[model samples]
Target: MKTAGRQTDAIVLGAGIVGVSIALHLQERGRRVLLVDRGEPGAETSHGNAGLIERASVVPYAFPRGLSTLAAFASNRSIAVRYRPATLLRMAPWLARYWWNSAPGRLDRLGQAILPLIERCLDEHRQWTKAAGTESLMRDEGWIELYRSRRGLQQAVKAAAELAAYRLAYDVLDEAALQAREPGLLAGIVAGAVHWRDPATVSDPGAVTRAYAALFTARGGELRHADAAGLQQDSTGWRLSAGGEDWRAPEAVVALGPWSNDLCEPLGYRFPLGFKRGYHMHYAAAADTAPRHPLCDVEAGFVLTPMARGIRLTTGIELAARDAPSDSWQLDQAERQPLAVPEGFSLRWLHRDGAAPGSASLLTDALATLDWPAGEGSLYLWAACEHAAFRQIRAAARQYLRPEIDA
Candidate 1:
């Protein structure tokens, strides 16, 4: 362990994609940023996603309205969603708020509000990929949402009209067209698919985050291992303990994502943050039989994405406490149909207050405001900075120096 008196213009806690992006953007704006995380950047939720930049996600996911859908979820018979009764009980309030926000009118307003941000996701990622020289890790070919039944296809076609209204590009591929595009798909497994052509996919989402962190450090920003619990505010500003040293900054941004509440709740700032835990596992593909694009089994609740590691099968959502013990039943259920024999497995949990898009947009707007009053306490910059755009600038000064350490 080492100790030293260090100071920075802004300290960013949590080095996930959002945190790293915030740190990078602040650095570009000439702020000496210190990015702190308990583990390596992107090693958490950022690394485990389906890897789509989600340009077509103009609309956020709404709570199920149909009786059948609700029944299926309640009975745990739906592959699309699963919940533990105890977890649901604990999350009732947050879930109620989420349900209210998912009303047709509110959902529509949320979609329109998030559309501009969705449109720029690809371009923003492109800039980072180009600068970090991680272009090879990215592909612009988009993704597919495969339907197993005619009803599913019809519902998707109807949704396509709404997507077109937002000027989002997509194509409804019939069974034959789907086969033509992805011959490696299990024969007769899907009726058709909606090809979302605007989003970009990454081979390794975590690696991209690490690359951005590398670029941040290369440009003189600081990346350190720190406990966000130590965050404090006083007449001067913010102070945190990391690597046995006291780090002080006049301004600080908390980008801890799922664990953000740990620090913010202590500081008297509480948002109705919730969690939707998920899981993922990789499998080997037979020779020349890997998927060409990411494929979501719309009704089945799992996605098979062609990743650098292998075919990654990711689960939908599991409502549980953040620290709840892992359950592999979703993975077991998904594997029963033989998507692929799992060679490796991992579990992940996603934390969202309401809808991802809406939550992220609100969070980003809060973070971009720099003149937050110190008397109010340390700023808890939750998930808002994840997709927020920043003026790119490279910093030149290094008053504090530390060797690059990997976690």
Candidate 2:
């Protein structure tokens, strides 16, 4: 209890999948790591995903290039994206950069860079899943993207064709074929589906993260419960004092997801990260009644994936303050499915999104002031991501870690 991991080489301040994975990777590099968290690892942001390892996402999900989609977003009624007016206004500039970088040319460049990571995500995931013995948590068959309108299906087909260079395996399912794959879906609502065979899904994302943390600990890494708020930096490196103990490490990694700002701002490393909120609700599931594969309501920008809890209906981006109260309207709109009425364990969740390229200077100046050794900034930021907006953050994030991770 006295100065946990006092002699540790590094202290990772979050226990999400990214932090756990970072701990493991650092251990692989022969660093003795101390992974600290305020609550159970993965019980926060990482627990609430659609649980799809989108191996086939060769192209990133950029901003809608079409005016109709833009207009729909403006209306704030779209199931895929809803925003509180004030919060959206505050986030406009960041959103503008997101829109700007999402231009076809820029997005294509970004996609090409991250293709390797996306390509190898599942195989890498399988390696850990095998090590953690959580292979049962994953489904190798891909997820199905359901298009409500024939026009939507056509657009998707065109998009898929554009990614032919990526050689992703997918089947365009007609109505009958779609029904053949997922008979539970009420017919006539879904016009078609793109069954992407390359990606895989996990039944319990949180459990998978915990499993990874277990693997990290099994390798002689340490896990502790302490508020990252105790973290401080000085001439000696980094120090995190919690309760009666004062822990020290030569370096620390801040992967606290949405809460990264709270700690960073105190340390003079504030960046404009959009703490986009989302929601997920679980419904009871029966074996033969649920869809065989995860079903993404593409038009609605939601996913109804079968999980250990049941069918999890996850909503898309909600551009709000990191601490804003939950708005159930978005989740309510996602309930159009004819499946049995969902009940219980409905809660709003948060994930960090929206990275401002403009904030790079602020980050630079902060580092210039602090002047840590080498390689703190890259490994310290986000792997807590999703969305096309997040991909940009990640692509930029990769820039930070490449030198350190590769070396």
CA lDDT, candidate 2, residue 398: 30
Candidate 1 per-residue C-alpha lDDT over 281-349 given as tens digits, one digit per residue, 9 for 90 to 100:
776676456688898888888888877877777777877776777777777788775442222222221
Give candidate 2 regions above 4 Å deviation.
Answer: 1-5, 242-244, 337-379, 386-407
RMSD values for the candidates in order, in angstroms, are 7.6, 6.2
Give candidate 2's total backbone clashes: 0
> Against the true structure, what is each candidate's TM-score?
0.85, 0.85
- Candidate 2, residues 184-219: lDDT per residue as tens digits? 666677889899998788899889889989999999
Whole-model Cα lDDT per candidate?
0.69, 0.69
